[model samples]
Target: MSPKPSRGTTRTTQYQGNPRRILVGITGGSGVIYGVRLLEVLQQKEKDGIETHLIISPAAAITIKAETDYSSRYVEKLATKVYRFGNIAAPLASGSFRFDSMIIVPTSMHTLGAIASGVSDNLIVRAAEVALKEKHRLILVPRETPLTLIHLQNMVRAAEAGAIILPAMPAFYEKPKSIDDIVDHLVGKILDLLEIENALFKRWEGLSYS
Candidate 1:
């Protein structure tokens, strides 16, 4: 088990300067599109020196094929670096391997429970553990509906341990016309958390009430 962080520990580094490194983990959740779109958006921001290190879980490969038209190889090409799910020896497993933040988009309930319990059985969870222990930003984008009490409790546990629980719920206040619009809104929210400027989706300009 990874060591827990102490209360009120400050972040080791900020997302300043060029070449901001971000670690992205895509699990087997149904909304793999969010993960893929995040990569696409980050790839577009490569000129801004946003470097992405990606990890695709074994189950995520199956989800990608079942959900999206793009091949897994194609998805890997969007990231600056890619690692296998089972590679515990990867540099990301170490807290010394510096990164600005870690985002696990479409975070599976199983993954949530594992991270909440500090069970680093695989590279993704290990990397997330490093983020938490190192006091770096860790964002989890859970995509399940009708969440069970256990699921909610795990989320609370992870949150208490310094993880940001960002769900995959899309808002209708934007009046999105297509699925891409909805996905972009959530991806844009992720970018907002990263403090990266983007206009992927329109911001909520207050409505006029007559």
Candidate 2:
């Protein structure tokens, strides 16, 4: 568990020449690997002075165990800070918390509906609300197949509310060789949206059909 922040106290990231602070949220979605890979890349960025704050839903813990070999404990260790899902008092639950952006990897439909309806029942939802109100970057990576009209409508609503709805759709143009390649492609796109530099996947070049 990460250390708790004092009530109403401002939490600041390491201010060593414009370091990027990111907030990541993981929910009970099928593509838990997406969240795992994202953390791995962010951990590497620590050398560059980037700081990451993570929040994992209880359902996400079960999904992570079922979907991957890694334990939730290991995943938490990858982040610079971890906040309890129900800890609405966490610094990240406020707009005053200095972070560049927030990304919800494997954003479950339930979370999506909640955020779209302006519900802030939990820390993750509260943090996302703070991001939107503060006009900070907010990315949602939903991971569900056969999205229903309700899901699509929620996505549109979130987008209209200034949230980037980036679904976990990997492109085949990159000719991925392994599962990691595909995973990196999605993560790379997420990084791009965050304006973070990464060479995790091959970029598209001009092509000709002759």
Candidate 3:
């Protein structure tokens, strides 16, 4: 089988040392803006050796255009490269490709379920599975709501396989006043997981002076 359909421009104008080989997968999750914002932050962090390899499932393309001022064509330019999900033969589809990590910015339930069981039908799932088997960082930014038992079970399975199930749950501790704030907070958390340092939001460690 192949990954879901997608449409948008594919090319990037951002480049630097680009030492970071990061594969970013966008599923059909609701929080599409989070994925886009995450890319923007990472793009600006080019000095930190960040490079993005992107692949957005069909649904993600539609949702991102619907929910934000951005278009998939424009967003695609933020990354170093982009690939169709159908191309499982891509470099990222193997453990030897040597990526620093793979982040599913807005992982959908279906995609999450697929990864949980070690299914490698497409590049996103394969990249993640390879990351798991190779012991590289795999961060899942799940964006589902009112989770069902099935969702919980799948998350558990992925976690057991060394995938960090970091849902798109925003923190209120930053007292965010806008949607961008919320998205930025979640992106911040993701960067932290990728071991990239940033001051995307204020820390809420409670009365801390250090």
Candidate 4:
């Protein structure tokens, strides 16, 4: 468990150079690997002064264990801090969590729907809601194969509410040479939206609306 923030005080990232803090959430979905990969990259960045806080849904925990054999505890270790699903009282559940942004990787449609509807049944939803209310960066990465109308509607709502609707869709425009390359490309897009410089993938060149 991460140390709770002191009441009525600003909680800051524990790094020199005042690195930015980001909140990453992993929900139950097919592309759970994206969340893990993002964590791996962010942890590496932590050594260079970047900090991260994370929240993992029970479904995400199970999916990681089943899909990748990554011990949930070890995966949780990647973050500067981790919060449980039901811990609505966690610092991030409030607008004062002092995070620069939040991203929900492999966001389950169910979770997305609840967030779109302003439902805060769990810390994941609550944290996202807080991010919305606080006008902080909020990104959602859904990996669904075929989105339904309801899913589209929910995504539209979240997008209209200042959340970045970044689906976990990777493109071959850069001609990825490997599977990891594709993953890195998608992560690179997320980092770009967050205004974080990343060397995850090559940027598109020679592309124009013309």
Q: Using lDDT as the measure, which candidate wins?
A: 1
Local accuracy of candidate 4 as per-residue lDDT tens digits, 22-119: 99999988778888889888898886677788889999988988788687788799899989899989988887667777889989998999998999
Off by over 4 Å in 4: 1-18, 207-210
Looking at model 4, the pairs that clash are none
In order of appearance, the predictions have TM-scores of: 0.93, 0.90, 0.88, 0.87
Better of 1 and 4 by lDDT: 1
Summarize candidate 1's per-residue lDDT along 108-165 as a digit string, tens digits: 9989999999999999999999998888889999978899999998988888888888
What is the lDDT, from 0 to 100, of the residue 120 in candidate 3? 80
Error of 2 at 203 (Å): 0.9
Question: Is candidate 1 or 4 superior in TM-score?
Answer: 1
- Full candidate order by TM-score, most accurate first: 1, 2, 3, 4
**Which scores greater on TM-score, model 2 or model 3?**
2
lDDT of 3: 0.82
Best model per TM-score: 1
**Residue 196, candidate 3: C-alpha displacement in angstroms:** 1.2
lDDT by residue for model 3 over 115-197, one digit each (tens)? Answer: 98877898889998887887777889887789999999898788877788888887887689998788888888888877678
Model 1, poorest ten-residue lDDT window? 5-14
